[model samples]
Target chain A: MSRSDNAFNQYLDLVRDNAAVMAKGRPALLEAVNKAGASRLAEAIEAYKPASDEIPECRLDRLFAPDYGVNIARVPMTADVAASFRCGVPQLNSLLAVVANDIFRPTDVLMRNMPEGLTVCSLRQVPAEFEADAAALLADGADKNSIAGAISDALAHDGIYVRVAPRTEIEKAVQIVNIFNSPVPMLTPRRLLVHACEGSKVKILLCDHTQTPAVQHLNLQNVYIRVDAGAEVEFYDIEESSAATHRLFSFRAVQHSDSRLTVNTDFLSGGVTRNEFDISVPGDGAYTSLSGLAIVSDEQICSDSVVLRHLGSHCTSRQIFKNALFDKGRGAFGGRIVVDEAARFTDAAQTNRNILESPSARMEASPQLEIYCDEVKCSHGATTGQLDERALFYMQARGIPRDEAKRMLTQAFMVDVIDNISFEVLRQRLHILVEKRLSGASADCSTCATACHSQAPEE
Target chain B: MEDLLKVENLRAGIDGKEILRGINLTVRPGEVHAIMGPNGSGKSTLSGVLAGDPRFTVLGGSATLAGVDLLGLSPEDRSHEGLFLSFQYPVEIPGVTMVNFMRAAINAKRKYLGLEPMSAADFLKTMRQKRAVVELDNKLASRSVNEGFSGGEKKRNEIFQMAMLEPRVAILDETDSGLDIDALRIVAGGVNKLKTDQNATIVITHYQRLLDYIKPDFVHILYKGRIVHTGGPELALELEEKGYDWIKQEVDNEQI
Candidate 1:
C-alpha cells in the first residue's frame, strides 16, 4: 500500500478504537456506529488536536468541545410536516428527493422517475449495492484528525449517497432537505457523497433549515464530491439555520479530465458559521468555479475559507465571494489557489468584496495564490468598504427615503451573485431570502419564501 | 401672477465664510430667469442653498416656494413640494438601475402627495416618453444610474429626470458645462418642452451660449455674491461681446 494509504488506515484505526470506547455506554448510537464501521471515528473525538493558528479566535474551541452526556432522541416526522417540506422544491417528476429530520435521521428517500441505473441510498444502505466503492469513497479524502472532522465522525447518525451512471444526464436537480426540529441543544453530524460518473451530468441543491427559532443545535456536515471524466456537476449549498444554532460545514471535491464543476455556497443566516472548501483539479482540461454570498447582521458571524489546487495541465478555476454586513455582524473570507509545476496553461482568479452598513460591522478578507508552473496565470483581490455615500445621496435626491435607499443599494450589491443562478424560480426565492436576511428578519425555512414577511417601516 | 419662488435678503455661506451675501431673486410662473456670472460669484452656491443642501448654512433668509416655507423642508421634501435641482455633476450610483431609481423617486413623491404608486405600464410608458425628450439610449436607461456614462449622457439623464418629475420650479446648475452642440440642443429642447404656464426655471450658467437655445425672459448678472445687473436678452449678447470684464468693471465702479 502507498504511504498515504497506510497513514490513513492508522488514523482510522485510532478513531474507531476511541469511538468504540465512547459508544459502550450509548446504546442508542451503537447501531449507527456499527453500521458505519466507524468506531475509529469515535476514537478521533478525544485524540484529535486542532491547529490553533490556522483558525480564528471566535469561541470555536468552546463551540466544538464535545458534550457526550445528552441523550439522543428522534423527532417524529408526521405526514403533514413531510408534505410541508415538499413545497420547498418545485414539482418535478425527475427529481430524486431525500429528507432528513432532526438528529440526522433520513425520514424519506424517494427515487421517482430517475434515470435508469442511477443509485440513491443512505450511507448505511450503500454496502448492500456497491460495498467496495462506498467504503473507499467514504473513508478517503477528508482529514480525519481535524477537530471538525473528528467530531462529525463521532456523532454522525445518517448520510446519503448519490451515484449517476455513466453517460446519463439528469435534467432535474437532486434535492436534499435537512430539517432541524430539536427542542434542545444537540450535536448532529451528517455525511453526503455524490459521484457523477464519466460523461454524466447532475445538479444538486442541499438546503439546511430549522423548524423553529427556539431550537439550538450544532450541525456538523461533511460533503464529498467526485466528478469523473467529461462530467458536469452543479451544486448549491444553502444554509439558513436558526439564530440559536451553530453550523460547521466542510466540503471537498475532486475533478477528473475535461470535467466541469460549479459550487455556490449561500449563507443566509446562522449564529456562528464556518464553511471550509477544498477543491482540486487532478486531470487535464478540468474547470471549477466556486462562488459564495453571505448576508449577516445582528452580531452574527460567518467565515468562509477555501483552498483550490490545480494539479493537472490545462486546467482553470475561479472564485468570487461577497459579504454584506449590518449592525455588529462580522465576516471573514480566506481563499488560496495553488497551481502545481505540472499544471501548465492554468488560469485562476479569486475576488472577495465586502460592504459594511454599520460602523460596528467588521470584515476580514485574505486572498492568496501560489503558482509553481511557468505558463500559468493566477490573480486575487479583496475589497472592503461602506456603502457609497454619493450613491446614497443620489438616491435620496430622487425622493427615496434614506432607509429605502440603503436597502436598494445593498440589494444591488448582491445582484452579481444572484444573477448567476440559472433557475428562475430559485433566483427569485433567493432574492426574497437575501432581502429578508439583510433587513434582520429570520426566515424559518431556507427553501420557503412565503414564510417571511417584509420588514415594516420603523415608526 | 403669483411668484413660483421668492428669496428675500438670502444670506448663506459654508464653513462660516459668506458666499451668497444678502442676495435676493424672484421668479413668477412661466418665467425663465438666467443667473449668469463669472466664476466664484456664488451662482452654483445659490442653487445649492435653494436645494436645501446641508453643506450650506442659512444665516438669514426667507425662501418660499408656492407660498410654503422651503427653508424648513428636507431636500427630498422640497422635491416632493414641486422643487428640482439638476446637479452640476450628477453622482454615479453603481448597481442602481435608472429605472429603479426613477421609480423610487416617483413613488416617494406620490406617497407624499397621498397618491398611489404608478402602475408599471404607466411608469414604463412615461419613461419611454421622457427618454425621447433627451434622446437617451434605451440601454443607458436600463443601466446603473450614471455609472460609466459619458459627460453628455449624465447631463441628458439629469434633464430626462426633470422631464419625468415635472417640478413647479426647476433649477439647472451649470447644465451646459461639458456638452457638445448636439447634446446641448437636445437638453435645451427637452427643457423647453417641459415648460408650462404654471412652472418656472432658474438657469445658472457662466456662458451666454445656453441662452441661445432656451430664451431667457430676464438675465441677471451676479458679481461679488450679489446680483449686479438685471437686463433683457439683449444684455446676454452685450455681455458675450464685451465679456464679464465689463460687468466686473461696472460692479467695481458701482462699489466705489
Candidate 2:
C-alpha cells in the first residue's frame, strides 16, 4: 500500500478501537450507528486527519477523546425527551425545523409551508430517491481534514440536509436548535449541509443550548454551505453552553458568481470554546461578510479564527470581530484575508477589537492579509484596550454610580456588533442578554438551555 | 445671609508640586465670587480640589458646604451634596443618550436625599424645562453626551445640566473662554436665571467680559497659589485693563 493508504488505514484502526472502547455497556448506540450506515463511513474516516495545530490548547483535552466515558446505553432516547426538546425550540415563525437532543442524535425534523422544489429532511430519513444524492453531497461538501469534519464523519449519527429550488425565496428564517441533556461526560459530533440554488434566498438561525450547567460534554459541529450564482444567504450561529461544556464549531462556505453570503456568530457562554469560519469567493462579483461577538468571563476561554479568500476578480469581503473579556477570562481572534493573483479589483477589509475589563483579563488578536493582485483595496486592523477613563469620569461626574458607568461604557462598546442583526426581536433579546452577561448576572445560569426549558411547556 | 461655602488655607497640588499654596475664601448664599488670574495661577486647581478630583493631592485644606465637610466625600457624594462644576473641556461620552444620563444623575441625587426615583414623565418634564433655560436644541438633548457637539453647545449643555441638578453651589470654570458674543450672552443669561438667594455661584474667568453679563459680588486676583487681592467687581475690570503686571508690582512692593 502507498504511504497515503497506510495513513488512512492507521486512522481507521484508531476509530475502530475508540468505538469499541466507547461502546462499553452501550450496545444500542453502536447498533444505531451501524443501522444508519455510519459504520461504512468510519472506514473512510482514515482518509481525514485532525488539524490539531489549527487550534490552541484548551486545557480540557479529555473532552476531545473518543472514549470520554459516556455510555450511550444509559442515555434514554425516549419519546419524552424528544418532546421536551421540541418544546424548547424558539417561538420563531419558520418553515424548516431541526431539533437535536444529544450528541449526534436528532430528535425531530419538520418542513412546513416550504416553497416548491425544496427538500428538507434528516440524514437518516432521506427518501430513497434522494438518498444517493444526499450521501454524495455530505461526502463532497466539507473538508474532511479539519478536526470538526473528521470527527463528524466518524461519529455523527444524523444531521439536516436542505436544498432550495432555483428562483425560490424563503421569507422566514429556518431555525435549528441543538439541546444537550447528558448527565455524564459525552462527545457529540453534528453536521449541517445547505445548498442554495441559483437566484435563491434563505435565512438560517442555528442555536445551541444545554439542559443543565453541570454536564461535562464535548460538542463538535461543522456546517457546509454552497451559494449558487445570484443566490443570497444569511446564517447566524448562537452558542450558549454550560461551564462544563467544550464546544468546537467550524463553518465553511463557497460562493459562486454574483452570490452573496453573510454569517454572524454570537458566542455567549462556554468553558473552552473555539469557532472557525472559512469562506472562498471563486466567482466574480461575489460578496461575503462575517461578523462575530464573544462575551466570556470567569475562567472561560473563547477563540475565533476566520479566513476569507478572494479567488476571482471583482469580489468583495468584510469581517469584524469584537470580544469582551472580564475577570480571568481569555479571548483570541485570528483573521486572515487573501487576494489571489486573478482577484483584481478586490475590496477586502478586516477589523478585530477587544475590551479588557479587569487587569487579569487577557486578549490576543492577530489580523493578516495576503495580496497577490495589484489592483486591490485591502486593509486590516486589530486593537485591544481598556475602557476610557475620561468617559468613565464623565459619567460619574453626572452622578451615575461608578459601576453603572462602567457597564454603560462596556455595553456601548458592544452595541456596534449587536445592532447589526437584521431581525428586530432577536436584536432586542440579544441586547438584554449581552447587558446581563456584561454585568455578571448570568454567571449562575451557565446553561441558557435550562432557562429556555423553564419557559417550555411541560408535557 | 448664611455662609454656603468656606475655604480656609486650602493647599493642593498635582505630582507633589504645590499649586494652591494657601488660599482662603468664603461665600454666602446669593453671592457670586469671581477668581481672575493669569495662566498657571492655580485657578483651575481650586475648582479641581472642590470637585474631589483624585488627580490633585490636598496637602492642607478645609472646605465646607453648609457646615458639612466636603473634603471627606467622594466626587459623586459631593455632587449629591449640591455641588456642580461646569467643566472647562467637557468629556465626550459616546453611546450614552442624554435622557438616560440625566435620569441616572437625578435618581442618584434623589436616592441620596432618601426620596423615591422620579417617574419618567416627571423626569422628561424636568428635562424639557431645564433644556429651554440654556436654549439647547431638542436634537442635541437626545444625542450622546457632548458627543459631536460644538464648543458652544458643550458649554450650554453644562449650564443645562447645572439647571437640571439645581445645586446649592455651582462653579463655572472658563465657561466664557470659547464663546462668541451670542453664545456668551446665552450662557451667562442661563447662569443668571438659575441663581437664587438660597444658592451661590463661583465664576472663574480671566476676562471681565463675562462679569458684564453676570455681576460678581467679589472679584479676587489669584497669583502664585494665593489670593493677593480681593475687591468688588471693579477689581476684574481693573485687572483686565492694567493686566497682571500691576498686581505683581504691588505684591513686590508690599514684600519690600
Clash pairs, model 2 backbone: none
The RMSD of every model to the true structure, in order and in angstroms, is 5.9, 4.7
Cα TM-score of candidate 2: 0.89
Question: Tens-digit lDDT track for model 1 on B32-83?
Answer: 9999988999998898888877788998978999899998987788888988
Q: Which of the numbered candidates is closest to the native, going by highest DockQ?
A: 2
lDDT of 2 by residue, B163-233 (tens): 99999999999999889999999999999999999999999998999999999999999998999999998
The CAPRI-style docking tier of model 1 reads medium
In model 1, the Cα lDDT at residue A158 comes to 56
Candidate 1 per-residue lDDT, tens place, A1-459, comes to 333423234334434455555454443323443434455444444454444533343434546543422223334544334433443334432253544453333323354455575777766566455766665567764545465665455455457778998999887767676766545566666678888999999888887777646666767778999999999999988887777777888899899999999998898877889888998898999989888898888878898999999999998887889999988888988899989999999999898999988999989888888889899888899999988876776666667877888888888898888877775556777887787766656556533542321122334
Off by over 4 Å in 1: A1-59, A65-80, A88-98, A102-109, A439-442, A446-459, B9-18, B54-62, B250-256
